[model samples]
Target: MNFAFTEEQQMFRDMFADFVAKEVEPLAEHISEHEEIPKALLKKAAMQGFLGALLPEEYGGAALDMVSYILLLEEVAKSDMSTAMVLHVHNDLVSRAILLCGSAEQKEQWLPAMAEGSVIGAWAFAEPDPAGLTNLQVMARAADDGYVLHGTKTWVSNAGIAGLMVVFAQAPEGPTALLVPADAAGLKLGQRDKTLGMRGVQIHPVYFNDVAVPADAVLGRPGDAQAVMAAVGDFSRLAMAAIALGGAEHALSLGVDFAKERKQFGVEIARKGAIQAYIADSAVEVETLRSQVYRCASLADQGLLDGLSASIAKLWANRVSYQVANRMIQTHGGYGYILDYAIGRVFRDCRTVEGIEGSNRTQQAAIARSVLAAHGFVM
Candidate 1:
């Protein structure tokens, strides 16, 4: 199987890279310090067709394949993780979920506007509960005309700014998902969180108090929340792996540039045996992680939900990113600790990968279970 990108894909990557370098990189320091991604930037991305890279053309998207989508994400992440966070949550997770699972009417109603960036989508998951444990304790309830949603979803990316939300809730039938308008009655956005990294994305808690959604707002079949969640988890794992790979590449590049320039003991640091060893090890790990991520992406594009592959990719990429960023920091010496340099911010962003989407321990368990199942073990 050929792993090379087509000319169109290469062009897409180059164009997007240039866009990020001009539009995103210049604002990275401001976003990291201020903790807010400018709304105008998101609008600009939308106008550039960056927000709908995965949706079908009928829905106003670029109709790009999974490889192109992942490539766009990696490019954006390489420059500013916060902007990538917004795009990932909005386009990859929420928009893709709607496209895959929404009814024909639902798609017609939501996708076009969302594709144009007139409507922003946010995924509501990740409660305070520990990883891999399903807690059917949502306060949302369905009644006569519609479902009454009441709960607090924390660590929600694009919470306050998004125009729509795909909310997962527990009901008597089973866990259900609902598409809620951001302006829906009784929905309230809490204060923005000050996270360790990925700033400017506006993570926050959304409180729903007796918020009513139309009966048609439910996504997919009833009692299929677990399945929807599993699908989302799979997509998230692959996307996060892509992001981690990009961040690792960024850190490795910075380290190489820094080592070649900095003088130590009357010579360039790049000439030092120890620094060369660090660069070699980081390059090897980054390439390995990139291959694994691409494998998972290819499998997913083929509609193969290979849970073990996804989990392994996510686990390895996350760990590799952390190691690479830390080493980059070490190579930069005192300069790495300063906020003006991108290495420190990249380091913090890399650390967040191990915990989000699903923790490393959870991914390990999933992989183990898949292995046992493949070997004919049950339960």
Candidate 2:
């Protein structure tokens, strides 16, 4: 695979970076303090075709290659992770699912609206169980014309603002996905959670009491939940890895800049060995993570992304995110603990990388299972 980005990809990266610098970075603090991203910013991103970054042109999408999409997310994340995550769910998790698994009629119904940013998409997959995709508690009861969904989804990102949601529930055939309009009758949003990081995200518990939908609302075939999830999860994880890479790079830059400017004992801290070591370690991880993230992105573009590779990239990126952020805080000393500093916010936001998509343990389990299976250790 070519490590270097194509000319078009670089141009896209430049555009993304410039947009984020002018629009996103200035608002990062405000969004965190207010716990909400302004609708105007999202509209601007949609205008840039970021909301439809990976969709086909026929549906009003940008039709960008996966590498370019990764670059877009990476640039946005460098300025604000909340905005990046909002786009991630909209593009990678929900709209991409429809593009990949929805029937042509379904795509025709939703894709244009989604691309135009008239409707924002959300994914509702978790339940009381933290990892609810595999251990689903929601049930989809068969009805005369369609299905009636019952139960609640927890920690649903973009719940408050999503116009559409792809809700996962168990059907008679097996686990199934149903696209439900957010304003459907009997659907309710519980109070939003006050999270430690990514506070700008509007995560809530979504309750469904016999929420009914037509049979055509089903995404992909019945009993094909595993396949659909595998496809979506790989893409989402790769996107998360890109976000992590950009965030880590920003944190490392913060530390390096601080070290050069801060003075202790009549000299700059950058001259200290400990500070030098901290920056050195973080720089190495950031570079290594960059390679992994881009390679996986390229693989995705070539339609060769595998579960194991995606999991590995996500797990490693999660580690790098936390480590780099923590090191930045240490480099900041007492100033890091102060909320007035951007490092504190970055540290809090970076912590969510491990918990989202899948936890570190979740990634480890998947990796171990793959390795053991390859070694003929069958269950």
Q: Which stretches of candidate 2 lie above 4 Å from their native place?
A: 130-135
For residue 113, give model 1's deviation from the true position in Å. Answer: 1.6
Kindly list the per-residue Cα lDDT of model 1 for residues 1-379, writing each as its tens digit: 8788789888988988999998888888788888998878888898888888788899999888777778888898887887887888888788888888889998899888888898888888766662322564455576897678877787888886798998888765677888999999999988888889887778888888889988788888765777667666787788888888888898999999999999988899999898898899999999999888877777777888577888898899878989999999999999999877889998988888886777788888888898898899966
Worst 10 residues of 1 by lDDT: 130-139
lDDT of 2: 0.91
Which ranges of candidate 1 are over 4 A from the true structure?
130-134
Tell me the number of clashing residue pairs for each predicted model.
0, 0
Best by the lDDT measure: 2
User: In model 1, how many backbone clashes occur?
Assistant: 0
Q: In candidate 2, what are the lDDT values of residues 337-375, reduced to their tens digit?
A: 999989988888899899898889999999999999999
Once model 1 is optimally superposed onto the true structure by TM-score, how far is the C-alpha of residue 242 displaced, in angstroms? 0.6
